[model samples]
Target: MISRILCTAFVLCACISTTILCINFKEQQWYYVISTVFSNVSNNDYIDIDLKTAHISRNVYGISGFIDVKRDIPDDAITIEIQMSRSVSGSNNYVVLPFKYKENILYCWLNNMYRDILMPSFGNCSNALQLGNREFKGPLVKKKFEFNKCLVNVDTLPKYLIPAIYKIEFKSNGLAKIYVQLIVRVYNKVF
Candidate 1:
């Protein structure tokens, strides 16, 4: 009798707890969608700037670009970094490794730059003076794993260093691509 009573009480508590959880889970979401703009600039930082053609191929993947300041440039003038979301293959969307750039993630923070859509920079660049991906460093970013679509951000960087050019080469495990919806934004400082 005692054993049966304890089991029944346990079951009741479990049911009640589950009910409370369901009630609380019926709350608001944590994320929100937003408007977009990926306009292009007339410079070299953009190697394949096209919304119409940016696509992941069936066998291969990746993306890279020239940071066009619209004129002659230099090194160490700017800094750049990128963060990509999880990449899901066409075969199985859920089974993914997601994208990661280990370099920029090093030297400072412990949090990975993969969750939300964001723009990252490496060196000093004015909020107004724009820098680009690899525009200040010009390093080739290799892939850590595979997936599909991912959002990317290119920040101008901290504005203490000189202005320079850069290139961002994004390689991957699948045949994914980069598309430009509109010029992300325009920079007032022309090269």
Candidate 2:
């Protein structure tokens, strides 16, 4: 009889405690900014791109892999679209050409993360004169340009994050920063 009474009381206490202590799991986020080591991008001195490790888990989550990228250097040489390969892909936020130029202020809640820019398959973008734009304009030289290698931390976390390859190359040295918005969701099951 006593054991039965104790069991009943324990169950009641557990139910009451759960009602009082429901958990609303808060989502995690990160974002960072990167600047070229060089003061001014020039022929002798060039802007460098680098990559760093990023993870989604509260603890012990990290990502690393081969990053492959492709940039559409149009025939006219006016606009270019940088796209990532299927294998070299990332989760959460990504870069759009319009947001490529801020490095002073760091936005809160979401912090942008960047790592050393490793030359994936083609370091070509970093080397080409147009990409490799000749600092000193020659007979064919037209304008100066810059590009970015970046990823964003989204509010919504990805279901699965795999190896990603992102490309960054703009028609102007004015292009410096990238923007990304993330949206993450958390579900809890109470039985």
Candidate 3:
């Protein structure tokens, strides 16, 4: 009788905790959405200046550009998405990675950049960054790349160094030229 009573109590506590968690999650609100304005340097070269202060020279191969987070994210943000766009059509390849601000510098926080480049079975991006498998399509025809549901550790990095830089790499197979644009969106899910 004692064991049965203890088991019942444990189950009840677990259920209550889960309910509270769900309620809190659902209460999350929209914080901010950052989109950039682009200037075309050439046929396949575009950069968003509002977010970063980098010079994108030669459209062929470069860092493309960086996105700056205008404000600090909430500690309880459940997911983040960084959407990217290009300037060529047909099909190609690309990768976008997240970086973190620590102390006074920025370091590659997650290797989601390699998630699409690396084989499907092998991905080294932080578990929080890789909510699930990621995919990227070539060609500027379809302009938009999204990093979905990034699991960020708020306790450790509630605020990033001003103007967080998210790097993007473009691999056009040396066949096509491409430019770029970006938008960042954060959300708190009910689930």
Question: What local lDDT score does residue 176 receive in model 2, on the 0 to 100 scale?
Answer: 26
**What local lDDT score does residue 52 receive in model 3, on the 0 to 100 scale?**
25
Report the lDDT tens digits of candidate 1 across residue range 85-160.
3212312122212333543322121122322222232112112122333222322233122212323433322322
The candidate, 1 or 2, that scores higher on TM-score is 1
Q: What is the C-alpha lDDT of each candidate?
A: 0.31, 0.30, 0.31
Error of 1 at 111 (Å): 11
Give me the overall lDDT of model 3. 0.31
Error of 3 at 27 (Å): 14
Off by more than 4 A, model 2? 1-5, 16-155, 158-191
Residue 177 lDDT in model 1? Answer: 26
Q: Per-residue alpha-carbon lDDT of model 3 for 120-142, expressed as tens digits? A: 22222111123254332221222
Clashes of 3: 4
lDDT value for model 1: 0.31
Ranking by TM-score: 3, 1, 2
Stretches > 4 Å off in candidate 1: 1-35, 45-48, 52-78, 81-138, 141-191
In candidate 3, stretches whose alpha carbon ends up further than 4 angstroms from where it belongs are 15-32, 37-41, 44-176
Positional deviation of residue 131's Cα in model 2 after best superposition, in angstroms: 25
Every model's TM-score: 0.22, 0.19, 0.26
